[model samples]
Target: MKNYILFFAAIWMTVCFCSCDDGRIYEQKVDIARGGRTLKLTGRFSGLSNWADGYSVVVAGFNDKSEYAVITKSLPVNVADGSEIVMTLGGIGDEVTALKLCVVNRLRECVVDFHTIESEELAAVTDTIMINAGTLDVGMYSTIQSQVFDKKCTMCHGETGSASGNLFLTAGKSYDAMVNQPAHKNSDILLVKPGKAEESFLHLVLNRDGDTNMHHLDLFSEKEQLSLKLIDDWINDGAFLNNK
Candidate 1:
């Protein structure tokens, strides 16, 4: 009897949580009046990056005439927890008897819907968002080195920095070889360009997309250029040792 009871309880719990609103319990509610109707339609949700950053809004009544639909798609600015956002129905002046907001995240794998009660008292939402100030004061080149070492170069490059061809990336000698190395780039390829710096082999190495036997840094590319800027800034700023 006890075993059966436990089994049933588990099933009940699963059914309850398999809903959009409950998927990411991180929900928020914002009270607002829409279209001269004192109703709440949606609440912003926060604390996510692995989810889709877009969603769709829907409103309907008994007849198709009262039905309304719209899509909400926007790029999100990352915050401490996730991205900050505002939720709303896309249409106005439509006789909205019932409203639903469905969200699609970054991966577009998870889809959830929120609903409003009446035409007027529609929005009873949950808004959850975390705001992060956008700032990259860190040096650009060093950041590149850090990324190359931490994410890209480190794997095969090795801690000793001499894993392949004995080129040597070991901390003490890694920077030197990278700065003005000729053998690193192929004959037809000039990875790093000195003086100008931007046209260097390092740039080609990180941004390489052709048949260069090297595994590209697709995952690391988003911030790699910015990191280069930081590195360039550091060199111009006296190349001070920021041994972070």
Candidate 2:
């Protein structure tokens, strides 16, 4: 009789366990107002060059009316060039029916193809997404070296020897020599003030808008000549070390 009772009790417990197990299989959804949960991201960086400074993985929300994605936030990623980057990104609002992830250059310019995930797609993934940020452009610094200085002014400012104006248009030294440092000719003016474009002597020299009537070089409208506004944009953008 006792054996029969023990067998019945064991059967009852098994049934209860089976009932609770059914609740565990369900979808995980984000609360619309609470800004959703963070997702783990693993990705590879490719084709990074000396000019490729820093990078960021940005997440954007979708606009229903426009059927477009606009970047809402960015996850700053700091990793060595050409290495796999592993990080987590948040700010995924529940209302975000679609998500766009992109790798951007230091200037926040998109360098790689963007990945888009719909709400239905995101729900299907159990955990972790692997993304690859492929080859970025050589970027502004490289552009300046190859086109601006190399073609126009490297005769006076190159790394082969001591450059005139104490500026070296070498592969790696030009950015530092220009940013935040005062111009060789004028102490009151900066060569390339990081956040101050108009005040930079380089801009004044190129556009001939400085206190000194001395003109360095005028930018020609020829297709080959870089626009003078590029100098202004570079300086106004917080002239980052290593083009950060």
- The candidate scoring highest on lDDT is 2
- Number of clashing pairs per prediction, in order: 31, 0
Off by over 4 Å in 2: 1-137, 222-226
* Cα lDDT tens digits for candidate 1, 1-244: 9999999999988888787566455342222223322222322333222221132222222213422232233334243333234433333334434433333223322122333244434433222111222332122233335434555566556565347644555444556665545654464433344444445555545455554545555645552454444444434443333322
- Alpha-carbon deviation at 106 in model 2, angstroms: 17
lDDT of 2 by residue, 1-244 (tens): 9999999999999998887775544222333225454555555543233232354446555545443344445544345655665566565545556556654445444433246677788666444434444443334555555456666677777756879777786757778878778888888888888888888887777777446565565544543233355556656767654435
What are the clashing pairs of model 2?
Answer: none
lDDT accuracy of residue 122 in candidate 2: 68
TM-score of 1: 0.32
Worst 10 residues of 1 by lDDT: 55-64
Q: At residue 189, give the lDDT of candidate 2.
A: 82
